[model samples]
Target: MTIEKTETINITSPLDIETVEKLHAGDRVLLSGVIYVARDAAHKRLVHALDQGEELPFDPKGQTLYYMGPSPAPPGRKIGSVGPTTSTRMDSYTPRLLAAGVRAMIGKGSRSAEVRESIKEYKAVYFVATGGAGALLHRTIKNVEPVAYEDLGAEAVLRLLVEDFPLIVANDIYGGDVFEQGRAEYRRGGN
Candidate 1:
């Protein structure tokens, strides 16, 4: 199949509804600013805290969450080998977080139908980072600090200050899903 040229879009975190609304599936993005890092363990805790009527470690409103875990920093660097995890593992908790006002998420794969619906209903977006490119991904992280669930070690939720973090829109607020589209195109012989 031939690849279409997609313009790279530059965006910042703490994204607003207006910004998310403008994004579409298949568009490439360079995300800058703050993003919270969380994995399955951290996701569970965040949802549990919400269930107990407690505030999250960081405000979800207008913010982006990256489903990643970082290896221990090597020497002077602040982080090492940060990469996106499989998004499906976090699907069950995603709708709740989206409902709580998270504007976007960065991960590596397709989402569940329910999560896709929630993305539309909540005006949020899902982005896919390149899998198996942890070393390259780490270059964009300008700062990293522990945020919550310290005992989880690498799985702990941390705050990341990123510049030009690479991603592609996997699902958009308008019900667009790039994975589905790509599959359909392939089946149709890329016509």
Candidate 2:
């Protein structure tokens, strides 16, 4: 599918409202700096913590959470293949997390309506990483450290320092949605 004049942008994680608000759907980004990794199980624990009125393991404010469970690292590597998982799996808990101040999310696939609504309402953004490019993505990760829920192993929350990690802005705070836009364009083209 053709994206209309995709612009390459460089951004950092733990992004603030100002940074997130400026992104638009279909823009390509090279994300650097810090990001937190978590999958379904960790998401559940995080939401449960919120429900109990307990503090989250890490501050969600101005943060980006990557939905992935990395494989074991090979010798002489800081991390293993770290690719995105289907985003819909976290749809149920996304709004709550957004409300808690998460600024962005990185994963593959489209999100639910509620999640999209929350993205606009909370002034956040959603990014899509290249799915099957884990090894390439792994090369960008410079460091990794266990952050929380270590017992969950690969599913645990981990802090990663990445440089020029590639992604596309799929949903923006202004309600721009790349997936829907692409579909509409395809239909218009009689494909």
lDDT per residue for candidate 2 within 46-149, as digits (tens), equals: 99999999999999998999999999998988889999999999999999999999989999999999999999999999999999889889888999989999
Question: lDDT for model 1, on a 0 to 1 scale?
Answer: 0.92
User: How many clashes (backbone N, Cα, C below 3 Å) per candidate?
Assistant: 0, 0
TM-score of 1: 0.94
| Global Cα RMSD, each model | 3.1, 2.8
Candidate 2 global Cα RMSD: 2.8
Predictions in order: lDDT: 0.92, 0.92
Which run of 10 residues does model 1 get worst, by summed lDDT?
1-10
Model 2 CA lDDT for position 6: 50
TM-score of each: 0.94, 0.94
**Deviating ranges (above 4 Å) for candidate 1:** 1-6, 188-191
Task: Give lDDT tens digits, candidate 1, residues 1-191.
Answer: 01232568889999988789889999988899999999999999999999999999999998899999888999999999988999999999999999999989999989999999999999999999988889988889999889989999989999999998888999998899999998887885535
